[model samples]
Target: MRNVKVIVQGGPANEEVRTLPAHKKNPEVGDKKTVFSSHLLMEQADAESFGDNEEITAMDWGNAFVRNKKTNPATGKIESLDLELHLEGDFKKTSKKVHWLSAPTDAHPLIPVVLIDYDYLINKKKIEDGDDFTACLNPVTEYRVNALADANVEHLKRFDIIQFERKGFYICQGTKDAEGRMEFGFIPE
Candidate 1:
């Protein structure tokens, strides 16, 4: 197993921190990135319609990585520790830069999941109009404009590939409601 590099969030906003240049590249790959961080605002995509790739577009999907390490109960040994999740797919359309799920591949590290919910609340308060939306995966989720019974169901139909439950995929779309604000949501299919 490869050594896993972890970047634990540190200190206060005012705290000074030092860093090495190599791991701080423009497109952080492997274990060098953070999820749901301020970087989310860096890639501002044009708001998309419901059930689209808004969240996907904002993400550095190509380089996204998940660490998988599990212990075997039989021998009480940890297996596959520091295993950086990987995807294997055909070179075909690789030039187009498709995600591992869409591309033809025997290695499917990210499986398509279902959309379980849309939005719940923040600090015991419901977001009145526009706020960043979140999802609960089953792997699945949805929104007001996005009904789980609608597009949510269809995205789970993995006709072309075998979607392993071990991994998951998230698709998000952000758009303005009748009242304008930055409202975003996570989609599970």
Candidate 2:
């Protein structure tokens, strides 16, 4: 299986961040000689959006390594571990970038949030003069996804607009409730 790389956000402010330097001579070897972290924290969710897909390089002393499982041929049981070199610069050729949210902790509690999206009220994009608009109305118009936002989301007020990375912009539906959960409606691009 190919390894996966993730860009993590939304956790404690004091969390560890690492950087690595790309090889100077060969621009293709790394990330165009751009300086970035060699050590990246491997994050997991309470319920992973994808299973066994995020196990790429794991966190350790300044070096990123992928764990390759060795299994016995006779019994098919796992036998040993093999480590493979995976650097931040190697992302161009082998890595798939996935976005993740770090788990909530007491130091940086996450704000519960619901993101709602809507289908077109009228299915047709443009209606001709003789077309019946009511017949084209969409019955199911809303889709909601429960998510956790960074602690800073507490500062958001009703009707405030915020951009969710890779998810587009959202408008705050209302203020946080007693349980510290709020709702946002997706704004189409």
Number of the top candidate by TM-score?
Answer: 2
lDDT of 1 by residue, 48-146 (tens): 111211111212233222233344589544332221212332333232222111111232122222322354343334544555444321232233332
Provide C-alpha RMSD values for all models, in order.
Answer: 20.0, 10.6
| Index of the highest-lDDT prediction | 2
All models: lDDT? 0.25, 0.49
TM-score of 2: 0.51
Off by over 4 Å in 2: 1-90, 125-134, 176-180
TM-scores for the candidates:
0.16, 0.51
In candidate 2 the C-alpha lDDT for residue 188 amounts to: 83
